[model samples]
Target: MIPSVILLEKGASTIHADVGEILFHEDSMALFYYQVLNGRVRLSNFLSDGREVLHNVICANEGFGEVAILDNGLNTVTAIADSSCTLLKISSKKFFEIMHEYGHLHHVISQKIARELHFKLFMIKLIYNRSPEEILSNLIHKLNESKRLVCQECNRLMLTRQQLANMTGLRVETIIRTMKQMEKDDKLNIVRGKVFVPADGID
Candidate 1:
């Protein structure tokens, strides 16, 4: 299980935000490091053409918005609450102070940052693909590996077809059609409007 904010919560302040609330904007000063105590946070960047590319979806017990602090530079991406969220906010200076006391906190942060980098790089390659079925399958597998969602019957994917479309840059119509095809192929199953990978899992 991923570590929650305990050691790092030393001088942190808890804040509640509603869905779609912006925690910080790109190019803004990164004064704080944030951890999600509940709900999800989306890290994304807007293109010059007005397209938004989602970089990461950080869930409960995950920490984010630390890159700018480490570099002493502006934020590279905007953070928005994907759902009504509980967040722990700690000043950059104080965050370091706590890290010094709890050395293992540094390891946890490093591992998470590395995983985020790997996920984004994988998505960059997956996003340019033209095959709908292949893209969707790869995306499902990736999400499972990233621990963003589990694949068991009791814990099926919570993402809607539209949400899958946004992640893959596909249209919702395409997502629905592709899902139907995948379902018919026994690659996935949909019950009560929730999507699930097959019992044998994605192979």
Candidate 2:
């Protein structure tokens, strides 16, 4: 990920967003490269049926909206703040200029795009004919492996049941029920409504 200092040096500006604030809309022009300085951001879209499809959760120190900028196309997903967030943003033109000046940035961005594509492909394969428990387990495992868990120490899952449902294409009720069963099976622990995976991961 690009450092804050570099972004600032290149004229990136700081922006604060409250929870539920929309950073950008799907199908809108991509004009800036944004990096989360604090808190979480959700990248998602709505289906024809009005159901939400979660794309990715942008956490601190991570960047989003680059793919649209790189392709010079509209954003594929809408970005909203999941919590009060501080972000650094640079104009797309300036971002491109910086990329050109820093040849290694191309490699970094390529790896990021490739990793995201791999996850999407994996999820597509996983959701086909997979049980809710299987789907949730694998998704959490993958996120953990990627160091995307909100709390690394206790392995607490930061995503809400609704968010989990959005990601897995399952109903929120199904997520709640399956997660409770998972806790019963000792695959995870639900402490005060929060989910915590064991250090060694699900059984």
Candidate 3:
């Protein structure tokens, strides 16, 4: 949905961030509400002692930093560029101005909230599961069913290696090794930037 330019008084700005670049730090003054124009954004958390832990990855066409615009005057998590990326941003003040002008914007926000809650539930299930592969399988199915380009064989997203790590809650090194083994065994073609799930055989 194109945000009505009339209601939002923000001056449009674009930003490009390199791999692993910190876009915004936690507790930073809420200035801009961003949309991923290219690449991905990783929302991460830090422990009291400053350990960087990945919370989740925001993919293409997603919106972030809306919560602060809705309630708090500050942000909750640090957003970092998952890789070299581009973002289109609108200032927080302008973000809320449009929110107030168009009540329907809340509906869009609700949808995002729903997806986040669903992801959280899936994570909880993974935490309690006895088998990590089973957990990964379940996540693969969830994302595949949600309507992105899924490899027909493994049902994994046609995303980059790092993306697989973010989606399946595994390390990139581990996923790469596993993918290679799967490919060697004729499971499916696992390219670095895509997972080609074949039409059949992995029943």
Structure candidate 3, residue pairs in collision: 153-197, 153-198
Query: Tens digit of lDDT per residue, candidate 2, span 1-203?
Result: 99788899999999999999999999999999999999999999999999999989999999999999999999999999999999999999999988989899899999999999999999999889459999999988998888885478878998999999999899899999999999889999999999998889875
TM-score of 2: 0.97
Between candidates 1 and 2, the TM-score winner: 2
Kindly list the per-residue Cα lDDT of model 1 for residues 1-203, writing each as its tens digit. 12445534466788999999999999999899888888999888878987676667778887887778988999999898999999888888887777787788778778877877887788889989889998988988878765576644455886767667767788889999999988899899888778887655677
Error of 1 at 7 (Å): 5.3
- Local distance difference test values of all predictions, in order: 0.80, 0.92, 0.69
Position 25, candidate 2: lDDT: 96
Ranking by lDDT: 2, 1, 3
TM-score of each: 0.88, 0.97, 0.74
Residue-level lDDT of model 3, residues 29-129, one tens digit each, is 77888887778888877778755566567766777888766776777789988778887788877777776777887788878877777887877777466
Among the numbered candidates, top TM-score falls to 2
lDDT of 1 at 144: 74
